[model samples]
Target: MPLGRAGAPVDWLVVGLGNPGAEYVGTRHNVGFAVAGVLADRWSLPKPKSRYRGLVSEGRTGPGGPRVALLLPQTHMNDAGASVG
Candidate 1:
């Protein structure tokens, strides 16, 4: 991994809290997921891929931008910490 000119690792960790699977999609409890999706679009991020025990998308804040890693845990919301760790 490369560090940005900011002098440290310039990265963003955007985590969306929600239950796994289709039944949870668009539900009120998953608002964070919705927000993350919006951010991914706004940032022109790649679609989510399975990694780090979650679904992830990678993007940059702008051209020559800071790195961003958007994460949606596959575990239940209550277990999000496991995926994060």
Candidate 2:
């Protein structure tokens, strides 16, 4: 299994559900995605790359905090599980 900076397996999987399109940016529907972006920045994770049909970022919470995996599905909210699964 992939380990975090603290050498621990990922302890959290944060999924941010939203639609994909420029029109949705900054809208209430994209709140989840927005929050995910904030967390990714706060954690200093690498820029999310395409994976599992979504954007993904992985890193630790802090020096010795829990490892986290963040996902922002590229699919619509109803189909977000497709990317997650």
Top of the candidates by lDDT:
2
Tens-digit lDDT track of model 2 for 3-84:
2335556889899888999999999999999999989989998988888899888988899888899989999999998998
Q: Against the true structure, candidate 2 has what lDDT?
A: 0.86
The lDDT of each candidate is 0.80, 0.86
Off by over 4 Å in 2: 1-8
How does candidate 2 fare on TM-score?
Answer: 0.87
**Location of the lowest summed lDDT over 10 successive residues in candidate 2:** 1-10
Which candidate comes out best when scored by TM-score?
Answer: 2
Give per-residue CA lDDT, model 1, range 1-85, as digits (tens).
3322334453778888888888988898888889988899999988788877888887697799779878898889889998877
Q: Positional deviation of 72 in candidate 1, in angstroms?
A: 0.5
